[model samples]
Target: MNPKKLKVLSLVLASLLFISCDKPEKPAEKKIELPKPASMLTLVPDDTIFFAGGLEPVPLKEWTQWSITHFNLSKEMFNPQEIQKLREEAKTDGQRLALQIWEDYLATLLALDTQFASWGFAEKPQLASYAIGLAPVLLRINLQDVQRFNTKIAELEEKAKVKAKVETLGTATFRRYALNEQEPLAHLIIGVDGNDAVFMIDVGIESQQTLALALGQSKPEKSLAQGNRLKSLQENYKLLASSLVYLDHQQILTGLTTKDGNRMAKMVQQLASKLKEENKGWLNELHSEGCRKDLQTMGANWPQTVFGYTAFDVKAKPSKVDALMVVESKDKPLLEGLKSLRGFVPYYSKEAVFAPAVFSFGLGLSVENVGPFLMKQWTEITQKQYSCSFLKEMQTDLQAKNPAAVGFATSMASGVRGLSLSLLSLSLEKKEGMATPMPKELEAVVSLSAKDPAALVQTVAAMVPQLATLQIPADGTPVQLPLPMPLPFTPMAAINGSHLTVYAGAKAEQLAKEMGKMSLESSQGFLASSLDYGKYYGLIGDVVASVDKKEGQQQATPQMLSMFEAMKQAKVRVQTKLDFTERGLEMTMDMTSPE
Candidate 1:
């Protein structure tokens, strides 16, 4: 590997290990009131294009230890013995340097004296200037004891056979590492200011200004803390957020489009012109007045999107994490329009979601009034006669598809409220000794909800003319569907006033019948899913066995076999739920792995 690539890899590995893992909190050697993680937002420039905030403060020493332990626990998957042997056989300076860099940096990070670390990023931009533009980007890591941190950096520099050049900007002093001595297109800038370890790539001449903004020597006219946009989101989600991300689409688009003589903008304009000359005029629509207005309207309608973790519990009996993302829009008409599209899928209560299955998924799709909604949107756009060529083309395409939407609305969409699919059971038959086991059973169900059972049956009948001959009951009763071809298992379908279900395999019909009484409570979201990992592991093993039995197929490797053995002894289950509120949509997932 190139030394530069090794250097980048070392930094990335150290960062990932340092920030993502955790262990039990230890008592601080000396009591101190660490600032709230959100306080880091005060340093961010208000015009930031994108920002990701790590609001949880983690004890660096404990975190590094935990990460190492977790990696060790999963080392079999990587076959560590092989990796170590390969390291021992390394001959080149770069290869030896790579292994040394990993060890030296890992040790340095693990021994850090810092009690807790919090990080933040502002103004998302290219980290290196392999591009034509420069945008303000800043990365800050909250630190204590700058001397200890610098000492660690010194050790890394020595091991990597690279040198750091100490330099200053305004009142801030930083260490700069050139990408290469001959052609230093980008420089990695690392510095300490007050409590932050500021990092940014010096991509251009304006980098000093960017670094100054990061170091607080130069301040934004209005900092993100002053904006208080996250406050409402925090309150709305009721999360003591471990992390939050904010993207101002409007600000980002305006910056990209409105800037005069912007290199990127000019390049795009050139491309559009070339395309227009070839009679592909849609690209030109981007620079059109109508498109600009439409974009502005779009940005205004949904000015920003935010994401935050509502609940996070990694130290529990079974670690769990829950996060929420919201697309904020205050436009009454837009919000009302989305509300009308909310499907009738019911809430997936614990009891309602659980079934005899390895994996199950259910989705709520809007069925009612879709035709009229599409027609209304079409009318508005057509009546306005959008001048943008792209919009005109899209309108033409939608007009062609409008009849299909109308057909869907009148037949199936107007009647069905929700859909559910479940993998009921899967297993391998017992085999003695070395003989490969055969598939014993597999079953699944597909179901939908509706107010009128007969309507659902009629809809299916219209699609499959053969179904019209069966004397299907409106009451919940299973009816076998005739297959045009031979199959190993029987397939049956049933319809009730509330649900229509199709079952594959013999026992699946019972599950279909039960669907008649199953609650159709609103899930309050578009989709939800659950997985039983213990069962999933068994399924995977059976699949691997079957594949291995195939002629000319290679048997499972020892490492892969060992991994499956480990998985068999572990119990894990995951459930996810999503919901849309007046503000935006929020999805949460919970994973349980009890000892």
Candidate 2:
């Protein structure tokens, strides 16, 4: 109640108010800057292909976590801790010092980009993607420690391996290495400060003038970083991915028809000839003007950029793969048919469900229709029989099997809306290495959309005899009575509703199981994807695994053989899918680990 005490209390309250009004001192905010992919564009010229992409950066800790799970990459080959221990021990030792430096440097590598650039190709090259002649391929790697990286480079010559020598290009210095002695393959330019390095293939560097320009010493008036085409393309694909790939359709097509055009023509001719021989006159007169025009029209009418992005959601329970891709459309003649063509999407068979699932694919009515339509168009243009022999056989066989239905439909294709075919290789269970290449044995299965169950059985009974393979062996063997089609699907076919199915192959047992055990209505993994791109170039449309054991032992085609070898030898299993839509053709492919 005293005046002095009241004044003191008021002063204390005022002091408390002043303290509360002053905001609590906040911790300094850390600013994080993500690397701009646009900066990579600055490294290339305006004449650069629109197809360019790179890895999106993450915080260092997140990157370490992702690499451990995604790649299982560690500092050591067998054990990360052991590798680090050895590396640390080797650092001071004379004999292991070089090895230690290598280990240290390699562990510090953060990211790298491999870019395909056509700087020296013909100005109006017809086909660019097909430009295999020569192009500058840039390999850029971001590193953490510069000194160790430099040491790693210098110690390379000590391994008694291919010698690496230093060469100067304008203001830039390159450590050159040639797998081929006559011509060095790689001319690597390092950053002056050492956290980065650029590897340019020595193939396209004719003069020092362009090399200087590319090195950012005599900087281009306009940088690729300033370019809008690639920047927009990344945005269009929503390029927030760990990695991505893009194709320059404009440059590729131009290269194919331009300076490298002849090579392209020869390749097509060779393929056509081979296909005709194998399929029995299916691709007759392939290199003719009409055929060339057809091919040209399909390729020419698409967007310049076709891109694909891949990311992993490892946090998910099953760890799903989140792969997405986009292909821009064009106004082409076949575009209408691609969009309108409809039927079944690709199916993951019952065989796929239990059979180690090698590869399975289903194509719709639109794609099957292309053969007949092309046959008609090609026949009219070339004035020759351009029909598909397989389709022809299928038509005849279907007619013989189901007279009334075949008569109504007329063509096997007309009666058929789509074809579902898959190859499953069960190498996963087999421990023994294949002595020879696995054969792509076709399990001939006939699927018809007939409503009557009895009619479908009678249809199978008739087809069993005709579809059997009659072989006059090279060794003069007796001409045995024609063997009935080798299958459990003999005598009668199973009918579930309107769908009738039959199978023929050395390993046709799976088909028999599939017919009765797996219902036709249950088609999982059936991709009803749109066919937008005119044609896919990379790894799309090649998800086939050997289905039969007998087929696995047979000789394979060179391409099939190479792929099978990779499947057997390497842990890499590449998957590719090609789809059609009214908008454009779509192509997607990525490497996956064998399950």
Candidate 3:
């Protein structure tokens, strides 16, 4: 009675089974584990005000290759023919030995292909009360091969005939090179612990506790690596950085001003007292309690700064870098004031940045409010009536000059919002054997933007009466400016609804016209710059040639010539920008070279 029904149900179940088999189980997501700061950071004391560490390992060859290229030390320099020529040309034994050592070092770099391990610097406590002296420093870097490094060092020492004195502190032994015979604290000390090399500068045996602390025999009560600050930084910048830098601005200011619980502060007080005894009234102003409080107030604006690389692509056709720097601040008014400084950047500004040029820079500023902002700051300083003697004087002067400052800030010229400076083109004359090669072709432009272009031109014209007579148009039209003195290139000016541009060179009028038509608004940022190294070096070479000729020389020195040759091979380009974001003021730089 149900045969048909049973067959239909079986067919439906078969189809469901086939669908389930085709659909695979959802794969589990994999979490990425981020790298941490250098292990040696754990030994750094909590009192350390500044620290910088690398999270990713960098090959030693990277540094060597850069040095080789920058110094024009090519493979040919190490070849047998060049080596013989260099030796024969050496004027002294010192020169010959130095050349040989550099060649040996380069050869060694080829054989040793090891990479650098984690490294960091931790500021050490100073033991003196002098107003000026080298600050104590401690740095630790791990060696990939201690034996090979030590062997190379030994060879260098033997060749130079200058030996470092061996000294011991507890169980740790170090090689010390005295930088100054009269100063006990001025020495470069290097100690090896396993694969880690501990370096100390301006530290003496008198600082036994410091020596022990640096050697890691005595553990600090609190360490940077074990702290939540570094942990938080690592977590926030996870996978985005190969290195990180931390600065404690508040701690530094406090340590300098506080009289209690800080040896450096105490030393500062003692120095201040000695200066007072010598009748140094100017230096004594800083030692007063009023100055300390003023300094503390200023320091509260920015307590700390953190920096790291967001992108580092060295393997690209041209290497690129993007970094982020954060100033940890909670003062809302101060932040708002700083943020207000950024103005409307037009799209043409970016065109100017990327356009082929020796050098170019663009800066954006909120022109409308800058005058009021500056006036407000000056008023605050004067109204505060600071008790510090030096500050009191400043306050008095500002109170007297505030009226004039207000007038200047509120002037029509202050309405300008953006500025761009560029050296568009440059070339030397082609005349053979000329003593001074005059610029045959040169172009430069300075473009300005304003809230009221007509008002700005009127204000400028009032100052330069000659400009008033021309009656410059407001329809983005270019007008040649009359000058009392002759110029190498024609001076041109143009004004649109928002932009006022000035130009000099053969193409000044054309560039001004193009600038007038620029209508696209630029992306938000305060500053941007671009440079072409190949063009820059070419200009520099011409200058050097001119200078040599003026000094009665026919050609530039060999070193200068070699540098020009190397620069031609690299053909590097660089661009940079500065902007404000939720993360804080961010600056990015990109550097690339041709393959």
Candidate 4:
């Protein structure tokens, strides 16, 4: 062997060693990107609109009292000397006198407070207050002069009736006059003496035809009728008298017209406008100044106009309300306004007759028991069937925050038994709209020791696969394996509510035969264990299937069969043993075989 040849061989060996020592480089993992979630908004209604004080209507008595106290009535009372003195007074003083007279006259009521009380009037205070409060601006002319003119007109009307044959026309004939004398001074004459006579009566004999035309049946002439004594007398005498009265009354009632009333009305309208403007400005300031700061001082969110009409009623219990209001808004903007308002949560539950789904949502923290609470508060709120997914999600979120904390034993029992036990024992009905069917093959029971029983059950159900995963043991005799244990045992099927029976006659023989075919002792042992596992698994499946199939049939049957007979006997014996003192002892038994 040459030295060069040895060195070459050594180099080849070292190269092989180096190659074995190095590890392969791995590729980098790609990152997975999840889709962005949808934007969500929870809009609530304003609470102030429902509960605020100022939004309510003012009480009648309060309004009346306020009006009376604000106006000094004694100072406003009329004095005949004041009018004469007013002329000599300065312009400002005269104006003050005029205003005072106006106020006093307007405040004067034909009826007294005692009369109002006798009538059993409830809104008397409100009516009187409104009239008095508005009197100063409402009455501007002298009412005394107007009243005097009216009195004189009544006197002349009585005198004319006695002097002439007065026949009235149309509905005006039904109208009565306050004549100074009840009876005529002369002999009464009643007759339709042709067209000229009818025209005379229509003109009220000594009445001003200018004013009488409005009352007359025919078109009135601007000039006096010739040879018609009544028309001529009215033009010369009645016209002048009636005109004076008309002028006086018109001057006093001028304040009642649209022009005069509108001035005061404008002030009120301006006040309302200013209030709204101030509210808007405050809202803008709140937005800019940070809502938290405003909320701290205000205690809650501000009221805003919302959907439909908003009405407020503020009253202490056992007493009449102080104020009441009715606010109306229109269209979808009203709904938007309601949503923009704050301090209230909104919930909507919808049910569809034929659609594939329905939807519902909650806007705030809610209790599991809130469904009944809301319904109790507002009977109009109705229960509705919604999409199962929607309800499940809502329940999930709610339960996470406020889990239904069940005792350990109760939770364990519920979990092991699964929904079946819950359905049977608690009589919980299957909720409508649930798309997922409960896993029939795998039943679990959790011990009551678990924390948050409802959540634990739900968590386990969600985590575990419904299908069973089989694992073979390495050591065992060729005996039947029991079924995989259900978390909660069915007491009726279980042997003393602990162990499960696995093999029947034929299945037992078959399992033993399969175990005999294994070669090595280890293989033989593994085969035996596998047989037991298989047998237990098969038995569990059979028992579950039998229970599922027979439960409904047995429930429907009315016959007193062997199983039922045994149950009845047991019940009697148990009752007799306990002396019938026990309450809520329930037992259910089911038996089934394959067809």
Candidate 5:
């Protein structure tokens, strides 16, 4: 062979040898299947049940542990001796009580199972046969009660015909039956003389023969007991159904009746005609007490259902004072009377009340969690002088859905201090395409005292713009102002005297413009802003304002980058300063780009 051919052939042969010698690739292994997770039952002890004369249920932790132990024992998955020892160590009176109740419940279930088996039924059958004999007895009793109540009501109506002033208040008749003998059953006094009144009107009722029988009434025999139960059920059903109709008619009357005397009378007349067709009577008792007349008079045209009593002392004639104008419900009447009698005195202290409202608004506006972030901003904005109530309420509300209103109120007041800052934070979070970093500053401030100041700042921030926007023009001055651009960043800053110094970068203007554009497009401006900032390795600052185009629409405002852009080809030097305060911690970073 030629020398060149030999060399080329040798190279090819070496390549083939290398390829052949390479380890054969192994086939992919089959994935192992995982077992499904066991079902977990969390037994929460209901406090309400404890108050309602029942033993509290087991605690969730204890129940969980018990279940695990029980499962292990039954399945032979754990040592019985070890499980027993653990149970002994954890024994307590409460635990024992809970176990007893649980065991009783199990026994009841077992007994029910056994009863079905005695009737030639399978254990744990899906459906058990009910006693057919019990059904007819219950039905007859409920029907009888309905007839009896109706007859008694009719008799009362006939007796009251001589003295009762029958007037209709919508579909319900206010039958002012001046009883000859005062009865304790007539606990609700309507007139000035403490005349007992029975609403005598049906609200609505639900009929259950079995339930009625279970409740029990005077029984003549086994059959009589069933008959009485049926009567009671029917009576209840009639009452409930009738009462609902009356309530509905009353609501309708509210719309029809108006301040215009003729219109109000006409509405009442029309409603009376409707009631007469259905054999129902309607009347309202009038007494010279507690602005009840005013409420009735006001409600003549008002579109709401109100019931209660009112009393008012005659200013010059104390002897002729009036005491009762019973409406339909107590709460509405009382509220109205207070308004009328006290010259519209605010129901709650203004300072105390407004805080919760503000807090509610903030809550409705805020994103979940991110407490530390809020706290940091609050400290910086308030200069550690103010604290946050809203944020605290938010944290509390988050943990406990139904936190006390008093705590919420206090939080609201604190939040008011930092209203502007809080709103700015909200705006920043809501802005299109903007991302807000978790506030390290707030966590630091809250850590200082366990009281978060950021909550107040966020509250104040939210309230400032809201109040400003809601402000009526001073003395008829037309409120004309230039529309503000949506602020992607919340205006969080350290207040030094009159100056507000915020963290922002050179590209703030560009970022703001981008955010504004995103806002117009109804996009996530904040998230977009964050992404843009990230591209340039810039940190976002406070949010100023976020405004939706509509009057009541949301607005977005946020702080953009404060640092110079990172050079594409060079390392950047960054310096950061962190300050901790009573409110929260704040971090400031100064970055220099390499030339």
Candidate 6:
């Protein structure tokens, strides 16, 4: 070869050698195979609510885009323009400097996920099953990593400014992250099995028993993984499902009989005991055998077990998302009660309720002729001991206070057939060049349908101090009445035949005057009491457009604006149904998008 050509060939060979020495970039496996031998279930404690999710063949960019679109935000990826905007919004030097700190934190998070996924986290450690289950006291999060994940974890911890301390339990060793002393002590457990599998446990307390359970030194007599009912629930979601969540209500409620059980109960009892010697048995009723049996019965009467599933079809017409919830109950009381909701479905027709609303929520409850049913259920829950004459005869409990008012409210709630609250406006709008934003006006209409309106009027009249009920009529214009709150405000209310209308707002005068215009009839014309998405989307769009016209939209960049425009063209509606079934109830929520 010529001298120049030989030199070039030598340089090329040297470059090739250097490239060979470097670690090759890996293409992440599309399938996520969970850890086995020590599977996610092995880490779960007894009587837990199990949940698991999987995202196979979906890129991070696409997942994030879906999230933004759901929130009605632009789907464009984060860019320097957003960072510049963040800096521009920083009003002080401290805030401006903190931007970089935030960037560092976010960068650290991205780096952690990338490094973990880059090392074949998804498919390297294949398990027979994967899950995330929540017990009464502890939560177990188990997943698999590459064989050499611990060394990488050590280096990352140093860079991330975290301190880790090691603790051993039998054959398993965990790295506990130390937090600030002032903060409540939380244990972060990271343990690896002999197999290339790792699972994490985040517990409020790290007692010897908890560690023993995770290390497989001891086993529970009855665990969620061993329960046939829970296994069936998990299976229900696993068939053509992307995720699964199983909840055993009866087991969870009954599982709180010991130290390793419910944390809330244990804390309450511990504090009560510490406070005084007299508090030794304040919670005796809760811990009693009868009370526990009643609790289990209550769980069976309601929803004993719940199974959930979520699936998506991106290629479907208008793209679709479907969710199903199977609520299993033996007594069928709750499902029957829920079935009574069909009468209230006709309460979302009026668009005026959402006219000036920035955000709003309304629910119409029907309790017509349900006084006996409610009293019976309450009696059953309380074991019908008439602890203190119960509510049937409240003459003893409220005799010191206003006995008549208490008695009336009880009766009124029992007789209430239809009750609805419509929250209208929630934003503070300022006039041009105003010194400060105007006082936020919270407008709402409360409607109640009772068997006897006159009795309620009499009770309400006695409750409000210095309020004259003589202004109200059987069928007349609504009148303003002084509210007994600390604020100087008077709302309007009226009793008309079987219904009562109450209009309340920050501007009492405006609300009082508008009371006659707003009526219960406005909400009673709809076919469904479910959320009114059409009106909600329209209101949201109007609010965004108004801001875009003045201060401009949050998406200032051209790319972001294009994404925002694209988001508007996709119409989405979600309808959730809790239909009563023979065994229990089937609650299904379907969300579909229209292009």
| Top candidate by lDDT | 1
| The best candidate in terms of TM-score | 3
Q: What lDDT does candidate 4 reach at residue 522?
A: 18
Task: Flag regions of model 3 displaced more than 4 Å.
Answer: 1-38, 63-138, 159-161, 181-184, 234-240, 259-291, 326-329, 344-354, 385-403, 430-435, 465-473, 477-493, 503-521, 551-556, 579-586
lDDT of 4 by residue, 289-396 (tens): 233232322222212211111111112221111111112222233233232211111111111111101111112111222333333323221232222333335445
- Worst lDDT window (10 residues) for model 1? 121-130
Candidates, ranked, lDDT = 1, 3, 6, 2, 5, 4
Residue 100's lDDT in candidate 2: 34
TM-score of decoy 6: 0.52
For residues 1-595, write the lDDT of model 3, one tens digit per residue: 1343223223322322221111111111223221233455556666566655543433323433443443334443344555555545544323333444445545543343331111111111001101111223344544545665566545655764556666676666666554333323344455665455565543343355555666656666666656666557757864242355667776677666666424345444544554436675554566578887887777787677876555555456645545567777766665677677786554433433334567777888866666676777777778885767777887888777765555465565566677877777877764577666676666877777776777877887789877778666788767887889864667787785577877777564465566565542544458887777767776777677565354576677666666665554545566677776555666766555554
Candidate 1 structure quality by residue, lDDT tens digits, 1-595: 3564444434443443234322222223334445555466666666666665544453444434433332223333445464455456544333343454445444444443332221221111111111122433444655555676677567656765666677777777787655333322445566776656665555434455556766657776567678766566567667544355667777655544443334334434543444437664544455567877777677887888776556555466655545566777767664566566555453332223435467777777566656656667766666666666666787788766554457465555575667877786866765565446565666888877766757767766788887768656777667777879755566777785477877787656666775666555534446777777667765776566555444665677667766665554446566776655677555666555543
Off by over 4 Å in 5: 1-260, 276-404, 407-492, 496-595
Across residues 1-595, which tens digit of lDDT does each residue of candidate 6 receive? 2343233223323322211111111223536544332244444544443333222112323333343355454334345565566555544222332343334333433444454343333322222122122312222222344355565545545544454665666776666542212222334344554443333333333346655665555665544455454345546554222234455565456544333355334544444454556665535555666556656566667655443335555445766666676677676665566555432321322222333322222344444434444544444544444332222244344334433343444555554545555555444455586533443454665655655656667776687657544456667466775655633333577765566667666442243234335444443311222333444544444344334333553524456445455544445555555445655766665566553
* lDDT (Cα atoms) of all candidates against the true structure: 0.56, 0.38, 0.56, 0.22, 0.23, 0.44
Output the TM-score of candidate 4: 0.15
What's the residue-level lDDT of 248 in candidate 3? 70
Ranking by TM-score: 3, 1, 6, 2, 5, 4
**Residue pairs clashing, model 6:** 34-127, 368-417
TM-scores, all candidates, are: 0.71, 0.51, 0.72, 0.15, 0.16, 0.52
Distance (Å) between predicted and true CA of 522, model 1? 5.0
Worst 10 residues of 2 by lDDT: 121-130
Which digits, one per residue and each the tens of the lDDT, describe model 2 over residues 1-595? 2343233223323322221111111111234322243454455544344423343432323323333344433332233454445434332122132333233334433221110011111111111011112334243333344455555556544542334455566555655432122221223232221233443433323325445544435644555456565446556665433243455555444433333353233333433444435573424433344444544554566645445344443344433333456566676555655554544433442222333334445554533354555544444344433243433454455444433332334343343344554443222221247533232343434444322434434444467766344332222222323343442223223343334444444343345344344333343222432211101211122323322346456433445534333323323233555566554666554434332
Number of backbone collisions per candidate: 7, 38, 2, 22, 116, 2
Q: What is the lDDT of candidate 5?
A: 0.23
